[model samples]
Target: MEPKININNSTHFSWLSCWPQWTGYAAALWSLLYGLLGLYWFLGGNGFPFGKNDSRAEMMGSFLSNLNVDVGGPVIAIAGLVGTVVAIAMKMTWGSRFHRAIFLSYAWIMSVTLIFIVPDSRIVQNFAYLFLLHFDLLDWRVINQVFCIVGGFIWGASAIAYFRLTQNACGNCGRNDATEGSSAKATAKWGKWFTYFAVIMALPYGIVRWAWALGIPLGTNDSSMVGNEDNVRVEAILGGLCIGGGVLTLGLIQRWGVIFPWWCFFLAGKQIPIWFVMVPAMLMSTIITITGLKLSPQIIFMMVNGSITNENWGQFVPFLFWLPWGISLGIAILAYYLKRRGRCKHCGKL
Candidate 1:
């Protein structure tokens, strides 16, 4: 006879009951470590992430690049200490509405600043470079930015868990029995529109890029943009990514998002894991938003100075929509999550 196994008695199942508390602890630990790193930088330990030490620093282009170590370092250290305190407080189940509001706002502000503001285009560019097997862009700057992004994610998760707990909702599913039917349904309703909008935003860039790759000047008179084989390869790769990502965005609202599509061969008809789709979509959305914001200052300056002429306007124009594309995609992802995250096993909420 086969051995009987009691999965409920397994150690892996133990953490679920107290996951919110654990997440808060993790956020606190991250804040403390980051604070210490800031203190080290303030004390003139080498490798501060901003200003003169950052090789990619361009005045007026990056916010961090303008922050001198003497000022930014101590500020960072102080902020981290405060963040640690906030994380610890959030872990507990105490506080009035006003106090909770302040802490939650701080948590979200830190999350947004770390994930979206601290990172520049280099992080996204590194992904492209990595595709070409180039290792030069994989430097300490990228690593530091990635570290900040991880901290952002930890804090965001902790804040969300805290929110659910405070509201007396199911922590696993974020649904209050008293207010269950309205929010999720409404979000899912609006999600379809956001998905369509996201798809539309990507089309122009993808089409123009593909046109350029094929030696056709869709917006410019010059075909020299793709005259060389290397340039053509780069254009093609970027075009493919834009188009492919747009297609994948549609999956968020489609049947295939929940069940494997026929294209999956043996995996077809299988129920898709939510994280498999959610993780990539959320990460890509964040990257797109960061890239758009990072490039805005320089790009806008170029436009103002008439540096971007008719011959090159096409390449730069479509990217200006990246910020909106990212935001819409993010909303769509949230909607999809609300729609699909049904029947939480831990909380037994439907």
Candidate 2:
């Protein structure tokens, strides 16, 4: 049964709902700006263009050399593209639980890939050795892995629940038997495609991790690096699997939004708290998309010209400026839409 959303209920537009949107917007803006600034610093020669001869590149190269793999530029670009597409899709399809579910699942897959592929040891060691000399949080690996895993699960489950609620036919909306609609059919097809894509994407990392976990020597990497890599891969694989399974189940039953999977525990079969789901999802999406859009060009230019050095860092300031402005404007637009949607056409509550 599809749950009847009180779209016209003014009370539903309470500050609580608005706050998450605002918070997400703000965080996204700041993160995007900072990331751009960071990239500018990297490329303009003032900081370190990742592939150039700067301190940052040297550090990264050394780290990668130790890991026996080249740092992947295309993979990073692909992740950015996926993140941007999903974010924009979410914004355009705001009230549709089905679209939101698909977007959320995509975002989770990207996040998991980032965690696994980025090499946490490199990030942690770089920050500690190059940026923060006095920090000593090495033993917090377990805690960090736990947080990432939990976050991935939350995102995957949220996607499932939202999709389930939207497809439900027995609810107050009386929109059941709606599967014959083209939109419904298209969405179902997309769900299947996404499930297969996520599983395929996750397989490489999953195989390596599983082998490593069972005391099999898959490679000669350091124990810490191996463990971190395995954890990240497993998190991504599990998250993808959960989302794929949940969506498939929902599609089979024609249930769109009502949560039925007891696996979600506290949040199972419940209307997701917008704050917990929408807020973080929006923020993360905006940050990654905006940052990528702003920085990729500059990074490419620097890479081509081989001029990423300290002298060019000033050029990055523009990226910082554009990112915050863009993200803030995006948030404002979303807020306006939410406000407009608050006015119920059926009941005129707002």
TM-score of each: 0.90, 0.31
Q: For model 1, what is the alpha-carbon lDDT of residue 151?
A: 89
Best by lDDT: 1
Cα lDDT tens digits for candidate 1, 214-250:
9888767665775556778877887788888999999
- lDDT for residue 103 in candidate 2, whole number 0-100: 70
> Candidate 1: lDDT over CA atoms?
0.80
Pairs that clash in candidate 1: none
C-alpha RMSD in Å of predicted model 2 compared with the true structure: 16.5
Compared with the true structure, model 1 gives a TM-score of: 0.90
Model 1: residues >4 Å from true position, as ranges? 1-19, 59-61, 94-96, 218-224
Backbone collision count in every prediction?
Answer: 0, 21
